[model samples]
Target: MQIGNWKSTPELGPLYRQIREMGLERNIAELDAFGFTVLEPGVAAPMEWVRRLRDRLLDVAHERTGVPHDLEGGAHGQLNTQPHFKHQYILYYLLLEDPIFQQAVCNPHLLALQTYMLGFNCRLSSCTSFVKWRDEEGYGPTLGLHADTPVAHPIPVGKDTHTGNSAFLLTDYTLANGALAMVPGSHRHARQPGRGEGVDAAIPIEAPMGSLVVWNGNMWHGAFPRSEEGLRLVLTMYFNRAYLYPQEDYRRNVTQAILDANPKRLAVLLGLADANMWDSADGPDFRGAFDVLRAAQEEAGLPTTANPYEAQPDETDVQVAAG
Candidate 1:
């Protein structure tokens, strides 16, 4: 299908209304104070769209990364059975080239919510699809309890301030099914806290399918184990102040049509427009890029330009055996 073909549907109305009502400044303040916040129920794209996207992702995984995705068993389970499975880390832009995925990405309500939450000048840093099956067990085991910031690498000290990340659950997020576990307000802590035993301090976000969970990059969080028998799928996208590393090579991946069709804000997120038109610097202005996207989105009548993704449906497709 052509890119952005599904955008004309009426399914996105409620989401747009929600975005219109929410104030951007408030969302950012809440994120700053609590580390994370779950947006109220908003309109979600149809499940068929999500399924199609998943299918396309599996194809990309198999063809480019040699990761086999089992249609019946789910990608995570298949990968766990074979540790050598290689998958794409951030595939949204490529996925968006598909019309269905693009519709979901540009949903005005979701974009508005994302822009508001991240502050007006946010840009898409990374986009990834995570498939955790029953076999994978315990949040990939390798993932540590850490924040996305202070980044996993070394950078100039003050350079850390502009980074942030967000996650969208495309399925119901339950504690037993490897939901994300986080410490509220932990983003304010001076250093990463040790993972302690028990659940008192940890909060597992149990939101309905299609709920969006956004957090600051410094928030102390980690994925929970997938104890359930079915696949726990989620789509995560990170937004930054534009000075941080982007998850995808957006400059190369975006089609010129998308560049032309998209508003100036969306173009910046895709790296189609340069933020520093006035300044002649070899390095891209991460902050300026983010700002341009935010402004363009605002001009387009969106409340916020924050990233948003679909989660799950009301009914469970598969059941997990009790331990």
Candidate 2:
């Protein structure tokens, strides 16, 4: 089948105009108010774009990380067996360099949703290229059912607001292939017991390839174990209100050229720009981290943020206590 030009398609033109005009903050707010939203296929990107990304990602994963391109088996079976899979899976930042991936991240609809949930002055917290091999369930028991919020840390004062995560499926998200299961509205609940029943109901986010799913970080969600035979791949990106630490060190990962080219608003999302200062008891200004990054990006050629799959600092880095 011929791949249509998604960017030029009439079906997507309206959304494009909406995103261009609404601004990221307003768009994100709209999505947050609604709980979850999905951008229909061909609106943001064409299926071919996803296919190309998946192909490039597989190459990078194998060349840089040495993960087999065609590994068959569950993530569980690969556990402890493959050294690469032992740690968090491999990630490629260059993926974000792709126009398609950039569009996916800056997609006005998705950004608007994230901004609304996270509050104004939000930025991309992290971006990852994930390939869940067939039957090779090795990436830690499908994520436990929980909101994306930092479970251990209290929310930060002044900056306390809703945050969210979005995943762009590069392949079909089938129930048999470990699709993400989420509890709608669970983000509102404060303390959900581990391995308990009735915390919230799990709903599978099944969708065709190229579809995007954005949800509140507070919403309880996790990946289901795969029972089928094909790679379940996705490129996940997160946007959080300013004043929160990014999942990856954006100052170190993104290219300076990209940073120089980005609008100040987009630069802020990349953590190459700073938001207003807020007094806090949490040691340093806490929010100054982005300033540190912005300066570094200016001095250095570019920043190289780590992949989400990479090892993270402890809970302290991920949590923001509520005031």
Candidate 3:
């Protein structure tokens, strides 16, 4: 009798409820069942904004590498350097390159899904681009689909998602356009696939421009060879739990102006709220920790007052060495 009486009804968390409000319950269900989900155009952001992102990505690519890519024929043909594969260009650290990229990460629907997959305190690991063109050699799948999180086998189950990945389609994604190939339900495997393993089950994720495709970090995924005659543009945003190290040093490198321009949530996503990393002479900043708590409360629709440490510390003086 006591056991039956004490079991309280299960309820969705505030973040989960937020996701439902944004009409992403199905997307959440897909992630839970299939390890991946695609949010259609206009769901994540406006088509006009997506188009602007595409244009800016191309501009950054040209400015960084001095390559006026032939957009029609897919003749960009690799950046004359070895990337993880051929006929593709990997643009790293796009967040610092432009304000549009900053806006891209703060998208409400996108962030809601990101929070749902990772956690309320998840930190952005990286913001980059994948500019791919047709491969003359007829691109083959990588040796095997790979997991984004580098962890030991039998990756922990449940909500402790160590990492998560989202790819924003700047151009139409189709099997013919070398879209992402993912193994359905592979996240439950909790282990990386061996070479040539899981290939038979992999399917290309097709979505229109402006769509956002997200997946569990433990899922096995790779891209198909581009057969079409135009560029397949993508802006990828990677995320990790607060404890794990981020791919980009946003905490140390994020400028004050950038933080000022965006919402308070941006500071939280950039790892400014994480108080664990303390190399300062004055020791840990408790203010950031409170900021994090305030943010969580606000997102939960709880009443909260402005934080005393509303102005984040100036990190412009901090210098990080390049690889």
Candidate 4:
């Protein structure tokens, strides 16, 4: 089927209008040059909403692990039993945990950046949280710097980011509080970092609570060791291009009621608008593909009703197709 016209550059596309409308032109430029950008507090989400998100995450953590957490202090129970990585309590599939997470996934600023990185067909990969504190054996000596798209050998390095990460700071991020460590422009390297490699180049990303730090999928990143006395809370909302498999099975796991509660765009992000493998004789629905295309345009601030799939070919084109 025919497809709609897509602008060659981000600045020339509808997505750029959304970015410009949100005053994120600089952040977009940073992502191009440095492979990452930080959206300060009051830009990503409201401070009150960020606090509520933090509280809800902590409550859910307590419910699952049966350990009350103090964001300003510390917790006693170890939520993660795996010895391979014990520095933080990991909360997975947070989209299923609360409505607040759903709201977070729809954050306009985040959607703008994610759409820019992964395109309009971008779907959510995972929604998780990392609750870190000072470990008895220390947080980390090795930075564990690596690219998110490690599945590819000699990963393609360029402007296209197959995967992207938006980390929402629930608590104040400081060097002492174990802020994320990233190597600037490492996405251009086109390959994963070797063991203990890029340590000297890694720099801590410090920001206030409610801020959002986003990066390219190819960027090499890790975290600094926590020396402070409290928990460092961060909500990680990961995204991937439509062709990539998501870390969580959101398409299969998301309930109809959940889809109904959120905006239509949320359903698109959950992979509902795209056609999937058909098990029945009916086969895949072609409308879903057009719906996804329209949704992409809508999110990019373009006209949603103009579906190229429905456009009829002229007589010359018809004769060409017949030939």
| Every candidate's CA RMSD | 14.8, 12.0, 6.6, 5.0
Q: Could you tally the backbone clashes for each prediction?
A: 16, 37, 0, 0
Give the per-residue lDDT of model 3 (tens digit) for 173-250: 888888899999988887778887788899989999999999999899988887779899999999988878888887
- TM-score winner between candidates 1 and 3: 3
TM-score of 2: 0.65
Better of 2 and 3 by lDDT: 3
**Model 3 local distance difference test score:** 0.79
Which residue runs does candidate 4 get wrong by more than 4 Å? 1-12, 80-84, 136-139, 292-296, 305-323
Best by TM-score: 4
Compose the digit string of candidate 2's lDDT tens values, residues 242-261. Answer: 66777766555567666565
Error of 1 at 47 (Å): 5.4
Which sections of candidate 2 miss by over 4 Å?
Answer: 1-34, 71-100, 136-143, 151-160, 191-193, 197-200, 261-264, 275-323
Candidate 1 lDDT, tens digit per residue, 216-313?
77677876776666566666767766555566667666776865565565666655444443335465444445455556756665444442111332
Q: Candidate 2: minimum summed lDDT over ten consecutive residues — where?
A: 74-83
Give a tens-digit lDDT track for model 4, residues 130-248: 87887543435557688888457587645577899989999888888889999999988878888888888999999999999999998999888888788988899999998888888
User: CA lDDT of each candidate?
Assistant: 0.57, 0.58, 0.79, 0.80
Q: Using lDDT, rank the candidates from best to worst.
A: 4, 3, 2, 1
Stretches of candidate 1 above 4 Å error? 1-30, 40-97, 117-119, 136-143, 150-161, 194-200, 275-298, 301-323
lDDT (0-100) at residue 72 of candidate 4?
72
